[model samples]
Target: MANQPQDDRTSKQQAIDDWLPITSSRNAKWWYSAFHNVTAMVGAGVLSLPYAMAELGWGPGIAILILSWVITLYTLWQMVEMHEMVPGKRFDRYHELGQYAFGEKLGLWIVVPQQLIVEVGVNIVYMVTGGKSLKKFHDTVCPSCTPIRSTYFIIIFASVHFVLSHLPNFNSISGVSLAAAVMSLSYSTIAWAASLRKGVKPDVDYSYKATTNTGVVFDFFSGLGEVAFAYAGHNVVLEIQATIPSTPDNPSKGPMWKGVVVAYIIVALCYFPVAIVGYYIFGNSVDDNILITLEKPTWLIAMANVFVVIHVIGSYQIFAMPVFDMLETFLVKKLHFRPSFFLRFVTRTTYVAFTMVVGICVPFFGSLLGFFGGFAFAPTTYFLPCIMWLAIHKPKRFSLSWIINWICIFLGVLLMILSPIGGLRSIIVSATKFGFFS
Candidate 1:
């Protein structure tokens, strides 16, 4: 096996890695991490927090929300610290880090599937979110115009990716990411401030939304999934860090962690108020999307919807860039296809179309969030990094790090198991009443 020239293989591999989207650039600044993380962590999921609060009620809801924020932040720090743990080497992709912690093959099996689900699931949900927000904007602004089907609006939303997908690298989309970060903060502000302005609804009920014991159990589980879905930035942290230049003295972790702190603060600002205030205002009567609940101040609501459309546009790209990198890597390496513009066009277009079709079939945004959140996101966001940390760092037994990692893993496993049951049931219940492509 060690017969032929080894240098030839190394050179060929480096060439392909350099060509891949995630690794094509390494000059990004720390603030790039700041806004990109913002765009990634604070997505359409935040809009669902009020409904989640309603399901779990105030006590459990607030507790779960705060716990998730802390747990995910700690796990994220593990990822950043491990990024350049082996000086003179960088684990540039999630799967690469996975391969390092686990054996090469097992790591791919463990991480890639979950990572793909998080990335692709997010894209599918965003497709529905974008289209629905656009429809909301249209209906609010032009109430008298002919009504358009959500199917068409979804297609219109997918059309943007047909163009933006060609941007070729994460850095290329910095402007879009920055704008999305701003829009997220902006719309999040509008959501809370507008609700504050409108004041709480009359006879607001703080009781759980579900009546039966079984129903309450399911809803509580689903609420856990919804909160799990909100802190979803870990999937892309390493990929985002790959863009930042690193050196032995000034490792990437310093800047990456800096950006992550800023992003998390922004996340806290966006998530806490929206979840707490939105629930306080509308109580259990809140729509799955809080924006859909608010009706007054027509122009303001319309603008918020418009802002949602813009923000998801950027979020979609942030998530998709990694998927694109993976696809291109597989094609160029395994299939031996020459990398070209045509290859990228076909791959990205096919992906967009596939997500659009799935989104069209099941446009239940809330249920999808809970389902994907538990089935996919819980593993990737909540616990996988901790698992990776223990495997790589071998944190001292009985130490604080060891205890914390185990705790996260235990909670994450419970989240993965319980939340999916409720999320799946919710999807089935919603599906029974929903007409295809309507």
Candidate 2:
């Protein structure tokens, strides 16, 4: 009789644990979680940094990157804190956090579309990038084997991606992410080293200007969008956190800050050198994709492109998993659909097809990155997380924490407003140079 109350508590806790995603034995170690964060954070975005640096100049571009990194890390921790606030309840995904902080309808509206844009936009970018890389490799190897369009390669890559996207959950893809991370690091090194070797050739004009008069303010904000895109990994932070091991005594987020530190350090190490070296070598003439700017030993460049293809392939899955979960859950709960393998196959394949078609229709790579970076990245990374923290903690009005949150909220709103305009201007300018289909 004395122990009955304790037994009842244990049973209730067990019931709650069963409902949570993090209670599984499949939960990952700190290193695996760190790797997932790194994989999601570092992708084709790094390739665009040199061009951003060229626009903003080195000092401002580097400053923006560092500041973005710091703020993103803070927001990521705020997310972890919010997850802990509800105690036994699981806020294992961004949408859930949004719904918890706000209401269901509004919260979903706030997060879902932006989340979709970030994930699907990236997959489209990956398809375009992969297609281009394959075309480059094919052209280098078989110059006489007739010209193959990038669109065709994109279709072929999408078929393979459709197959890979069927992997059921996040934990299943950790090994793939690990391999992708290594590939990213490898190609980043190759691009940096190749640029160093190429140096500043006589024909290429180089400028290290602090500011540009060409587009003036428009150019600055556009460059800021590019830099923001480079660090916009907050969309998947909660998903990565969900993969970390959890226990009653030691919540999943216990080692999350340490993991975040390790991952972002690796991200900065990989990003900064590539941006600086690529811009140092090519200056204002740097191509949006730095790998494209390399005109050296054919085989090495080809190898690097191949690595980029692989890295993006893995990255597409990492970002898409959360989107997949949300859609699947909605189908299961709201639509009363059974959570069967057939349902999973149908939904996942349909999502892949949708992204593929979008990739084909709007093949403008840099423009898409800029647009998504501004439209989605600002709100998701900066504004929502800070606001959620404020709402959940109810920090004192006009207090230090409150003041910081407000400042972050303002910055997020500013970026949200400016980035889209800048991105649109960039798209229009690029469209003038190239057609929509091009």
Candidate 3:
């Protein structure tokens, strides 16, 4: 070991030493900091409300509420464990913890793909969201003009993202970030208010009931991916721990878990109401983007759209940055591409362009959200972290049935597979009906 070169340590290994400390002044209290984390998770979760409402209606719309209970329990347990594992280390990326907990190979396979999904999904989301927001704004501003188009807006927004991603201190957009938080709350509150005003009752008519029946089995599993994806952003713990003061005596005891818990609570409060109201107002008719259900004033919809657009952009960067950092580190070290400025630009531009194309081709949030949630996030969020916990801790006493854990994992996997298919079918059918494919 002494014979090894100093530069040989991997980035993952280096990050462990630079881990941020957890101190009162360094880390914000749960009250002040939790909403940031919570809102990010809710961003992805809220996007799927319209779709979930359409399939399951108000009865199973409560599935989101139910799932929050299960997710909270699972999250609390995970936080307890994470608090023990990651105090002093500068946990920059997911794989650092993965490598520390498990071995390198497992970390590479598990963390890498998961991060990719998050980044790509958020990018696609930003494009779709920004485009939609721009479309709405255009319509509001020029209701008499020809149908408002989104081509130019997409380009402008994408350009801004590229520029914003490169800024050093442009880490958080305070106003936009705050609006994302507030708009999410507002959207949910308004949705609930709308439901109450409209008197959204359960359909008692036999034909209405039968047609709306999302089979119990399908609803049970199908909803898992959506919920999993919605809650997957909890790994923000990696970022949260960075600002805390790291000391040996106080290393493990920190406020980060409090932040995580607080964040989850805010998320639950914001998302549950929105899901309930969404299902209440539209019943099975809710589209995937719940914003479509709003028969509100143009100003309100436009405001909501603006916030959603900014929220998507912020999310896109969160997922995008670490991946970019990892790739840049690899390229500079291995491929010798670090010396050239143009090469760096080319690399980033390529990534930006790829995301753009994906966003354009897959314009709808409903299908994209489902597919990403089911396939990518389900494994990372629900299954992988728990697996990592078991692998690292090797807890001899799990009184809780491993049977339930396995069942959750199996159901997670199944939902991931089904959400995409069902979501895509819904999109295709809608598109065909609208003459886009016909």
- Residue range 202-287, candidate 2, lDDT tens digits: 66544543355657577778888887787667888887887776555787787776778888888888888999898888888888
Name the regions of candidate 1 deviating beyond 4 angstroms.
1-9
lDDT of each: 0.91, 0.79, 0.58
Clash numbers, per candidate? 0, 0, 9
lDDT string, candidate 1, 146-188, tens digits: 9999999999999998899899899999999999999999999
- Candidate 1 vs candidate 3, lDDT winner: 1
RMSD of each: 3.4, 3.6, 5.4
- Off-target runs (Cα >4 Å) in candidate 2 are 1-26, 201-214, 436-438
For TM-score, candidate 2 versus 3, the one ahead is 2
User: What TM-score would candidate 2 get against the native?
Assistant: 0.90
Error of 2 at 248 (Å): 2.2
| Count of backbone collisions in candidate 3 | 9
Q: Which TM-score value belongs to model 3?
A: 0.79
**Number of the top TM-score candidate:** 1
| lDDT pick, better of 2 and 3 | 2
